[model samples]
Target: MPAGLVALALGGFGIGLTEFVIAGLLPQVSRGLAVSEVAAGWLISGYALTVAVGAIAVTAATARLPRKPVLVGLVVLFVIGNLLSAVAPNYPVMLLGRVVAALCHGTFFGLGSLVARRLVPPERASRAVAVMFAGLTVSNVLGVPFGALVGERWGWRATFWAITGIGVIAAAAIATLVPYWAGEVPAGGRAGKVPAGDRTDSLRAQVSAFRSTQVWLTLAATALGYGGMFGAFSYLAYTFTEVTGFSSTDVAWLLVVYGAGLVAGNMAGGRGADHNRDLTLIVSLAGLTATLIAFGLLASSPAASVVLVFLTGVFGFASVPGMITRVTDHAHGVPLAAGANVSASNIGNALGAWLGGLAISAGLGYTAPLYVGAGIVLLGLAVMTYAAVRQAHARETHSSPNSARSPDRKASM
Candidate 1:
């Protein structure tokens, strides 16, 4: 990988930190701000909502700008968001900082994928993107747990302060290390590789991406699929503590195993996607649904619960690349459409949280989110399977009588 990839990874790291760091600091923040836990949860909801809005709008507005300056601007937004969060004097002010930070979330991943593609050769684009996203997975494993620990001792404000410093370091590294490409292909491309000479082509010209139904379906998959995942994951610490009887310290260690699973899943998905995008999506998803349901059922035993959570992370996150590629494949020319998919992901995040809360309000057990999550994911899987079958049938209808003998590739479920 190029040194420039390091800078991209740094950007990913700051994003990773900002998104999950609040998990650790939530109790502290809720106490300090004199707010109920439910109200304090707005910090996450507000951010995810804002990010979903900005991912498409911001990325589209900047689609034609020079790559280097745009990336720099994003990093600037990242720094300011963290600084604002770190130093807020009141809860409202703190929410304001979070909103600012949220604006950077979707656009960075969208643009960052573009940058990663340009920094490496054709065969390695997916791997390149995975490496950058690894920063995010690492956050789940290390950043959230440690941030919680820091807040436990140093106060929640200090956690944001440290994140702010990381943002600064990330911005500096990006400015120094990333190469200036006056014209490079946007990282998210349709199908296979595009030539270097074509790298600087205008996103305006690729308007066809918006016209594809497959793109929209894939984007919906991201929202619905991840919504189910977060529906369970958002309340993980609470569940582990109450249901599994793990102490605070043990919760952190279990998350480490989850993180390891996430890391492995991302790498494997990249390799798997490059081979067959459809198959990768189907396999990852079926596994994800099974694991989530299993976690809910098997919570009776510490050992069973531990293993289920690990599999949940592994299967759940593995779909990320396939989802990304699936959207890009359908997005062909529309860079903003592709970018919009990132925001769709956060939208799912918020939706999942809301539905999960609904289950608890209705007096379901602590494990209700798990079952709720499984049902929702199964719904998403059904959508994908339907789309795949319809697409296959359409293809079959178009084939010539002579060519109809061609091998049938059943849509992956």
Candidate 2:
């Protein structure tokens, strides 16, 4: 792996920590800012919504700029946003800070995926992307817990201050480490002199990539598949306490176990996807669906629930690398498509949580979310199966004698 990937991973860690640590400190924020708990929760929802929008908007807006500089700028934006949150005197200001910080979330990962792939050989691209995402998994495993502890001992504001410092470090690291040519497209043998016309064409190409059915299918798969796991996860605390009979304290530790599974699964899945992208996705989704079903059926058993939680985390995240890679592959490496994939994943998260909440509101038990999640993932599995078949058919058609009649058929597919 390139040393620059370390910088990207650090940026990912800081961003992930910023996004997730708020959950543990919502009460502190609520008390300090004189806001209701429900209002404080909007900080999270607002950030997510902004992420989905900014992923595509910011990425497209900056498509003409050099990648390394843009990355550094985004991290600088992250630092400023966190700093704003750290010192905000009111709830609205804090929400503004979150929205500002979130503006960089999707774009960072989307562009970072493209940059990470460029840092390594083609065959190792998926693993490279996984390395970048490892920071996110590690944040769940360690950063969130540590940030929560910091919030408890100090104050919630202190956590944001810490994240601001992290953003600064990430910004400096990215500026110093990532090569200037990281995302540059040479123009007429010139290294970085992309003409205005070429820039316009680049934007057009990105928009045009969406014409492929496979691209849309991959994005849909990312949304539904990822949404399923997140939906169940949104209600996990209830399941742990009301259904599985674990104490509140145990819930924290149980989450650590689940995070451990995420870390393990992400790395393993990355490697597996490098070997076979479609197969890894199929197996991971199938495994996740089965795990959610098992978790729902066995939630009353403490031991079984524990095991299922870990498995759920494992299978849920294991699809990420393959999902991102497949979408980018189908779109011919358009950065906008990758951003769209990130947006889709966030949309999935929000949708899954809402649906899961509805099931609980309908008087379904805590396990209802798990069953709901499983059903959603089953749909994703079906979509992915269909996509794989279509992709296979396209490849076969390209290799046939009819290839001459349509040179762009493979690209269109």
Candidate 3:
């Protein structure tokens, strides 16, 4: 409800638009730049790769800096990138613009989540994250379509010009609304325990948090769980039009339905995670696995495909809040964990898209990607179950009396 949260969401909206709108405008961009279609596609892949690297490297570099200023600077960088894209006369220049914009992408989400959590009580931390991410979902539902429309009416450069305007607005809002103290600590943080003059925000300190086995497990779970759904989603247009017999135009509307589901699932997932983080993640992954398999079986039926695609969005995104929460929780206040989690998610994105493409090129049917996706999600479920069991065992070991007593010295004591 805070104006600051709205500003953060606006920033998210702008960044999300930059990331996805290109997919719809790829053809226009390719022709404009006089490049091969495959080369234009690198804009997306290169941006993604930059985001993954920047998520960790940039976040670590700025771990010791004030978060508000970092966010504001990142938005300024975003604006510059869009301006370059709007005026780019060659393919290489456009590629440079995308790379510039991407360097700030993951760090924004990572730092934004931390700031969002700081704005509220621990009980509502995940919900705050959900609110910020809502902007991302809305961008998919509205922004991508609008960008495509603008490109069709004018030129691809015109769309980037509009996005540049968005970046300006987001930067202004963030600079005006977000408080400096939002970067200091959460409501229940170690503020008093650490001296103001002797604060520890070094990269080495942040990296030490990875010493926890639970953190590694959570990262793996994020990569696998998120990858599973994206594998199917990457080829959704083909499945809907070719496999389900929907018209090309109908595929666009169906994507809107899936986007709507994403919005709903994001909100619901946040609330559920607030109550029980681990259980929410497990259920979401399990549900996604089932939904994908069912989708594969019913791909030929238009009605079933429509219903199942929406369900896939719901189950797929429902794990997100829990995933972010789990990573930060296990990190025990480490600054880089949130950024690392962002990197992990992007890694999953690349993996899913590649794996799904492989299934299609192997001469399997369009529905085959969905089956492969289901199997990947099943692997995620197995990993999560193991994490849960390990957690339970650690708790049991800590609670046992023998854990506290020295056997050689104290039989009675």
Among these predicted structures, which one has the highest TM-score?
2
> Which is better, 1 or 3, measured by TM-score?
3
The sequence of per-residue lDDT tens digits that candidate 3 reaches over residues 1-413 is: 88888999999999999998998899999999999999999999999999999999988888888899999999999999989999998999999999999998999998898888888888988888898898888887776688789999998899999999999999999989988898763323355422244333554447656776777788888888778888899999999989899998898789888888888888888989999888888999999999999999999999998899899989888888778877777665556888999999889888988899999999997888899889888988888888877776666665688787323211110
174-229: candidate 1 lDDT, tens digit per residue = 77888877224454344343323343235534454555566667777778788888
In model 3, which residue pairs have backbone atoms overlapping below 3 Å?
A: none
- Of candidates 2 and 1, the better by lDDT: 2
> Between prediction 1 and prediction 3, which has the larger lDDT?
3
Model 1: CA > 4 A from native: 31-39, 182-208, 388-413
* Global lDDT of each candidate: 0.76, 0.87, 0.85
Q: Which ten residues in a row have the lowest lDDT in candidate 1?
A: 404-413
Q: What is the C-alpha RMSD of each candidate to the true structure, in Å?
A: 4.2, 2.9, 4.0
TM-scores for candidates 1 onward, in order: 0.87, 0.95, 0.93
Candidate number with the higher TM-score (1 or 2): 2
Q: Show where candidate 2 strays beyond 4 Å.
A: 186-201, 405-413
Q: In lDDT terms, which candidate is top?
A: 2
| Model 3, C-alpha of 122: deviation from truth (Å) | 0.4
lDDT of residue 139 for candidate 2 = 88
